[model samples]
Target chain A: MVAENKGIEPGGGIVLDGISHAYSGRKALDNVSLTVPRGESMALLGPNGAGKSTLLNILCGLIRPDAGRAIVAGVDVSKHSSEARQNIGVVFQDDSLDDRLSAWENLEFHGLVYGMDKPSRARRIDEVLALVELSEWAENPVRTFSGGMKRRLEIARALMHEPRILILDEPTVGLDAQTRAKIWSYLNQQRRERDLSVFVTTHYIEEAESCEAICVIDHGKVQVQGPPADLKARYGTSLIRCLPRSPEVRQKLLEKYPEAQRLSGDRLGIVVRDQAMIDAFLSEFGSSLKEILIDEPSLETVFLAITGREMRERDEVNSKARGKRNKRI
Target chain B: MSKLTILGRGIYAIWLREIMRSFRDRGQLIGGVSRPIIWLLILGIGLNPYFRGEIYGEVRFVIPFTYLQFLFPAVIVLNIMYTSILFAVSMIWDREFGFLREVLVSPLPKWAILFGKILGGSTVATMHGFLVLILARFADVTLGWDQVAWALVLMFLLSFGLTSFGVILAARVRSFEGFGVFSNTIILPLYFLSSSVFPLDPSLTRTQTAATYPEWLAMLVQINPITYAVDALRGALIGFNQFDPWIGPSIIGAGAVLFFFIALVDFKRQ
Candidate 1:
């Protein structure tokens, strides 16, 4: 079965079949399975400690999953990491460029490490540097580059080898909105030009909205995986917030709709299913309610609906677990 | 292209980066230049006149050379030891600052990357050792071009072994702050105990050996692998050998292979 899978069609993709990994005694990833087809952009959405890192480590051939297989570009990552790595390029969450070397030198080193010929190394170094609009600073040390420029250089270096799949871990976490958009543009250009399978893992809901598909994971388990529109439609809620003018109206509204939640600021929120529900709500309590606000369904709401936990509340636990797992080989 | 050619390019890429980094590091260059000068020019000259072994107004034993000539080859060894062992800083920098992952994720194997790094370090260390050889005329030690070339080979092998030793140190050390203590404890004791400065020869006259050095000191010197390395350099540069000449090259040759494999084991684990 493993031999049959090697270099199959849709070779520029990733497949994880029941990949489970544990660090010491605690489970970091538990029987997780997902796929990124060729020429597709998929986001692995998770907060810290949601097993995103462990899955990434396995995909990049940094660590082998305790059970199951990780196949990248039709090569089993654990069994044939060198071949898998040849087909995949990675941009880590940490800054990995040599600060002492110039931007051109960094990309050149990358080209050589990937075993490009001298002529191609020179040509691709020019092409990638220009792609990121870093040709002017090509001779400048990376230490002098701004955070965004460094990020751009890293993106350029990752693509210099011209790998079929590009894996980025939280590519644009701290950048400003303009830089974030520019980075996306560079990434999107690669996809359009090379039909690259771009797999990115990020916690940013707005960022994940731009991908073709989204996978939401939490507590080492994937809760939902589908297109953004499908996820938002299936699990995302459209809430109708009603602020009652009088306590009697509030009591009547609460009795009529048991699911009506008393929201702060003296308002009640109801998960209105369809237009009929909104119409029925308006006809019954149009005069009693002082104000009404409609909240549309979005990926944010879908995440909250699926996870049922506040991101901020898990910050401490997640960071501690992330730290402990990072120390493991 | 063949797979071998591709892997060779990857190793060259890694090695080229180290050479470029070393060239740019002015502080390291300064140390490489200043360390040899202080030991050879100042220390050698200051202690030259007082080096003769004399007792009861008669010379007990003669070393057959001036203090400056005797100290010249050892200073070369000292310079090589410093540069080679401190090559760990580059390894530490890569691991600490995330540059290691860039290479780690590449298609090349672990041993290829490590070999490139060790080769780069050994090359720089060999150059640092050569800096002292250029000053040989001032030490009154005349050498033919053949001697210089032979010493380079021995120096490079010693550097290769010590650079691998540095990589071993890098794997065990958690941070750079501890390296200050590591060099003082490890590099210093290894240098002093290798008989680089003090020649503790077992073949010396019994009275000369007994009056000057202790039995324990001679034991430490003989057991030290670096003693053979320094001895090899002394043989190459000044035609001096306190032990069997083959012993020096054998230990150095064995160390180069042994430490490299050991370092490779640690690197693959990472």
Candidate 2:
């Protein structure tokens, strides 16, 4: 038992060690180990049914793993979950806000739940609301807030007590691209300003690139973990996108490159093996082609190379499986 | 002391949220206020004549009180039962809407969270019970300050027990859609079976009582814990007793402790 500072309240960032949880007979997490040292950011990248939520639940002290030690904020979670919860703030995958209450009321409730003193509660309420740019709408009920506003308020409420470790489970799932970008900027700013360690689970590959470290999980196992640049350079692929002028031209391109695959919007994509392939294609068909664009190696291409499937294609297949597991946790 | 203060803040926060929600809901408030008015003002007055009328051509009183006075405290109990037992709906709302997870991840213990919710529910129920006392004058029943104070304490205790029982119901019922109908089924049956609307003659011995009324009806009044709760309030406000005085207060006190423990156990498991 590692003693926390001053007394027995849990303190520090996440330290999940060999933590494994199973639902009846199905294993959701299998010998998972990860660490987010104090004041750092780590993104958990996984598709649906990849155990991201299960991992987040364990970190937030919502579920106790069947086998292994989870030391969240220096406290053994299975033994003292309440204490472990002290240093951890969670924005769950689902909308957990009480829409009936005002934005201020929700923040007030959060502060009190975390045992913030009256003055501090008042002070932090204003600070966090401003951080999310929701200060003017504090007294308005959350029911009237748009989805992006609700997401923003949820983030503000989670930061009310200034938790040492912040755990967000798919924090920006269904929002528009602009709102998604805004939320990420707020989170990045929070990380920079506070001594906060963030462990966010997300399937958005482009956004995951912003984290200091990335862990790609699939089938309840860690497929890879490293900085974004390293993972991209090693597993990522550059592709050439070409729109043929006619059926004859498309046939000729496919004949020359047998591996070329049809993409959306009448585009054909060919994985670039080397620089010579691009030179040969451009010289051969640059004038004849309707359009040609070279996509640089990115997290999307890295995900494709590692997982062997586009992230969106796996959505429907695993959703039912994920739903069954979600009910238990 | 520090730990206690922290737990206190957490409890107070949760309790305050429930109270605020109850206040904001116009529909629940209407039900709480109007329920007692209809039962006491109309039902009691309309039935007052027959409570003291001739029985089988023999002039007699059922006990010694008019129907209005006899039904007053039980009406308070009825009001409290409606508010407290249906407090489960609030729990269901929280669960269905995902609001419960916010507090579950906080530093508060499971027991504290449950206690705060039960406390909030009982407070609202007790207020509904208190609303009935304003009609004491209308019912032709006078009360001293002490009686009113004692009645309030008893009402609070009963509400506490019933609110905890509501939590037990909420834990069992998963869907919010069916809980209102399901709780109505439970509340109305329990209210009717508790002898809230009628009095069982206690002057006769148990065997004679069984012969006079249907055996099942007599048995149900005695067996239902709510019967004693109503009887206890009746004793406090109207100086009435249908059974041994000790039985009413004892059952109420015991039920408050027992049901709360059941709720706490269920809450911890969740």
lDDT of 2 by residue, B176-266 (tens): 7678788889888888888787888656234335556787888887889889988888899889888888899899989999999999999
- Model 2 residue A54 lDDT score: 88
Mind giving the per-residue lDDT tens digits that candidate 2 earns over A176-224?
7788889988888887788788998876666677888888888888888
Clashes of each: 0, 0
Question: TM per model?
Answer: 0.88, 0.88
Residue A30, model 2: lDDT of 94
Q: Show where candidate 1 strays beyond 4 Å.
A: A1-10, A239-295, A310-329, B55-61
Residue range B9-86, candidate 1, lDDT tens digits: 999998898889888999989988998899999998898887677657896335767888888988888888899889
State the DockQ of every prediction: 0.74, 0.73
The models' CA-based lDDT, in order, is 0.85, 0.84
Query: Which pairs of residues have clashing backbones in candidate 1?
Result: none
Report the lDDT of model 2 for residue B255. 93
